[model samples]
Target chain A: MRNQNTNILKATIKDIIVAFICIAIIFFTIYIVWGSEISLAISLVNKISIDTSKKVLEEVKLNSVTNKLESYPEYGTKYGTIKIDAINADLPLYYGDTLAILRNGVGQFSGGYFPGEGGTVVCMAHNSTKYLRELAKVTPGNKIIITTNYGEFTYEVFDTTIVPQTEMEALKIQNEEEMLVLYTCYPFNSIGHTTSRYITYSKLVDSKYF
Target chain B: MVKNIVSYIITMFLILFIIMIIVLNVFSNTILKKEYTIANLKTGNYYERINQNIVDGFKDYTVQSGLSDEVLEKIYSQDKLEQDINSMIESLYTGSKINIDTESIKENLLNNIEIELEKENKEIAQSEEEALTNYMEAIVEVYKNNVLYSEKVVEEIGTVLNKANNIINKAQIVIYLIPLVLVIILIVINHKQLKFLQYIGIGLLATGLFSITPKIISELKMDINNIMAINQATSNLIQTIAQDILNRFTVIGIIMIVIGIILIIIHNVKACRILEETKRSRH
Candidate 1:
């Protein structure tokens, strides 16, 4: 009886091994024949599968020595606030200058620099009563303060201009000096869209790092 | 012994063939079939959820335009959204040009904008007419894009799907024919000893395990439920489809494994009984 049981057990083990060998052969043959195609298919699927596990926002830090930021805020997310005492306007500031962002508060042009980066920082907001409608009242010498998670900086308005919306030169990004360019749709009270931008240029006057 | 080895080899080939059939059929039945996917979308409430997404998306634009949400009201009916989405999916499956009519949306928006302007006692100046046209066009564009996801992407997928269907149709003949030939050969070789059942059982067992392996690995490696799409509604639909596929694969695998195990057990019992009888006769 014991011998019979051992024989049966051995036979079953052999059957299992054979099954595994069959699987191995199938995989090996596929690898030999269609390996590249399979790999390409996998890579394509991976490309479209968005991995939302990655952080949507990261901690932003200003590098004082490099005159740059260690990390930047995610676009479309509010990272700071812009305040102009002259207009009594205090609004959230996002990194990307999209109309969607402007709907809520102010949006910084992603191409520009962060405060304390010693470069141009451009921001825009909708010309609504709640947003930058009072922006026209702001003149040169008025103060605009930007408060971020890392630091605080004050900018003194040096000039204001109305330029055609097509004039990209008015919002030029540079690194020579820390400047702030704030803009809104011109003719703030217009019922619909306007063709020009009201630009307020300011120079950095004070800074406080946290 | 040599004959036995050849039978096992044929059986291995048979198992590999069945696995291919399972994979191909799974794809053909679910993702490849336009009706199947459309059914999934309907059961998943994709239309209503996507409608809400479009509405929410428009809120941001309306706020920037200084228009009240009233302008968006009744601009896009749920029926219109459903019709457009279904048309887009049909185009994807049929490899056809997708043309979503934004005319209705554009007209509705213009009328609403005019109503809002009337309320404020303002007229669109001749100079501002271009801006108004652009604004209306932009809103219509947003509506179309939100409904279709991305036109270029959908068109490319439609093209690829057409090519794949052509290839699959041609391959189906060979995919089915070779397996039948292998099974016939296996039976002819093992018929005298009645050993064909054992080989077939072993083939099935291997195929079942092979089918289940990918599902197990995917579940361990990634969280399929949290798979993101362009928006929450689309994301939910994608997750549902993925889960359905995984569940189907698992069920098919289990069924194969169960049947395979039963056949193998029956063969083993018969072999054991024959051996015992032969021993008694020798004694």
Candidate 2:
């Protein structure tokens, strides 16, 4: 009887051990495959966006701003002609991209209004690529020269600020002074839209194309 | 008595050995790998977001400060008007106290607008030089605020990732040790079941090895990928090798478990048949 009981006990122990091993192997395999797959997918997405931006920048012509009204394209239209050179690199500037000038919510670009009009003109751009990242490195007195079809408008970087998204009034066009406002999302490599906006202010120094 | 004591000691050793195998397999496969991967991803994301927010905040501040004059002028003027109206109301109350005429309050407000307009024009004339300075100062303030915020975000992310990693490490140790403890307890209670317990221990060890092998392979693969992305060529190579070893171990563990289960079942059937035969012979 004792021998039989011992056999039963051995068999039971063997079964339990076998079951545990099976479960562990299955889980381990799954963890490895899933982790690698997710990492690869994320990297691929980031690379694609970077490549696209680089391609677009390469094809665009870099011109100087010469004319004012004649050269000013329609509002909200994206033209690839103007490039802003600041911080030793040239960034493609688009018109009607919404330029908010003030750290406060007031100055913004209106369709017919010129740069000298007393209001802030807000310009928006994507920061995922290198062009916008270059902009993030701008320091005081760094020259931002906007090259338009009509003329080349040069502005000296005077200030930089970070403000909240609720402050849209800071982008409103005000009759204060002609100011060039540049803005992009705060932080270059963030996953989602953040609470604040990055901004730089520059005064119109010269416009040769106009 | 001596035989019983010897058998019990053997039984305890066998049980303890089986438990250790089971625990080691669980610890290596599931807990450690899952925790590390999650911690790394979360920490990376947090830092990325912090950098982004700082940039975005600066953009908004510049835009708003440039445009503040236009928006504030309208709002400021309205506020000034409201203030004047309140003063007039206060004066009216005083007039009733002193017997001064209420019509004079209306006349006083009309004069205030002209004064306010002139003041606004003068301020506007002086604002060009002041605007740039003020705008620059405001931006500097915003930039400072953003820097502080980013630091806080980064610190918080670091803390969470560290805590998670620690917990997972502890869990791995506990899981790996539990089976060994159980085996020891079983051995102390039974004497004659030593060989049977050893078989069971072997099966459990096989089961644990099979279960953990695949997980270990996957984790090693992930570690390799991470190292490769970071340009750590040596680590990547080592991890790749580790991953291969884990894969083979997993397969072997699975086969062992299957064999163990078959043996256990066959043994039980044979034992049952013997019992039946004995009963028939007695009858």
Candidate 3:
């Protein structure tokens, strides 16, 4: 009876091992063949990537890139310096004229023609007493010199006039000759919005291209 | 009698648990063991994700800068933008990131400006070009690392993923085989009641179907509005993936069904043979 029990026990253990092996082989084959696909499926179900509706990402800190500008100035960027001897005005000149740009310093209107283009070069600034306020007191032949990356151009104040704010035609580019226009708000020291513009027109008397 | 009853209950629980382990192994094999991550990124959808990220970044920039939408769009066409980013990603893999010199991507993007400008017929002068280039460079700087996973993430993902796979595989194998071995020992101890193994067969069938419970629950509770709100391609891909998961479960379930039926047949045959022997001996 003892021998018979031992034999039955041994057979049972063999069968159990065989069953476990069979189960393992079946599952192993599946993992070997289809593991990645199933995992991807699970992941896809869990992921949140994109949708039709718009939602912004979390605010990330942006490290400002140190801009390495070429030697030549670009439009809307500060590229030169200006000096008005009569007003003692020395200011950094930017190419594009916008409200924000003017707040910083004098800015040239980009829509108008460029220097050496034989057209009107319009430059404007805020009417601060220190900057362009003294333009009103300037007489003809006052030296207005612009130093740029490209070259330096000196202009002589030949004329000055107050034009209406709506008179954009007064600042129109003339194709016949190169002229520089410096203008600011009227009253020389206005606190609020103004309709009249203080204009100082000058002819380009001398130019030196670097 | 009570001991026998307790033994049978334990045996049934053990069988159900083992069956569930088998189903989970299939899951572990796919999601954990396979390198589905890099492959999915390599798919066309990776580009789509990138395009979306770029659009998002630009949208954020415009909101902050007060730049006109028209001007920003005119600066760089979306297609060219995505292509440029794709090129950057491609470069990072100079056949393994061993020589992943990311500094070159900045130069590469700057160098390829001629083709982009030409495509749009934008006649920007030298000054304008300089300004635009600076703007583009600034944009690239701010978003280059933000738009995707970081360098550390990229470098370590392969090893980290495989390590997880190994651990889960070992755990699953342990859970699966331990109960199976116990049930085998129980069958030997309760030889007279081996016919009760039919209960285990039934449990296996039930567990097989239970494997797809996540899919069923998700579908039942799925909001139609949410689906409509998602992009069509993404939504479609999601459905495809869900279906694929369901199909895998169904395959395992069907296999269990076969195994369950076989177990039931074997138990019935053994019970009938014992019944015949008892009747003949009494006669």
Best DockQ goes to which candidate? 1
Q: Which parts of model 2 have CA positions greater than 4 angstroms off?
A: A1-210, B1-198, B205-229, B232-242
Candidate 1, superposed: residue stretches over 4 Å from native: A53-58, B170-174, B220-232
Best candidate (score: lDDT): 1
Stronger candidate by TM-score (1 vs 2): 1
TM for every model, in the order presented, reads 0.91, 0.28, 0.42
The TM-score obtained for chain B of candidate 3 when compared with the true chain B: 0.59
Question: Which of candidates 2 and 3 is the stronger one according to TM-score?
Answer: 3
Q: What local lDDT score does residue B95 receive in model 2, on the 0 to 100 scale?
A: 25
CAPRI verdict (incorrect, acceptable, medium, high) for model 1: acceptable
Overall local distance difference test of candidate 2 = 0.47
lDDT tens per residue, model 2, A113-210: 44433345566554434335456788778776655444466778788887876787655455466567777665553322245677887777765633
- Candidate 2 per-residue lDDT, tens place, B1-283, comes to 6644554344334433443444444434532243433334243443344334434544553333322222212211333333332332233222211122323322342244235546555333343434434444444444334323233443454455446556656766665566555555555654242434444444444554544545564654343333332112223333444444566456656665666666556556566557767888999
Provide backbone clash counts, one per model.
Answer: 0, 101, 4
| Full-model lDDT for every candidate | 0.82, 0.47, 0.58
Pitting candidate 1 against candidate 2, the one with the higher DockQ is 1
* Native contacts retained, all candidates in order: 0.33, 0.08, 0.00
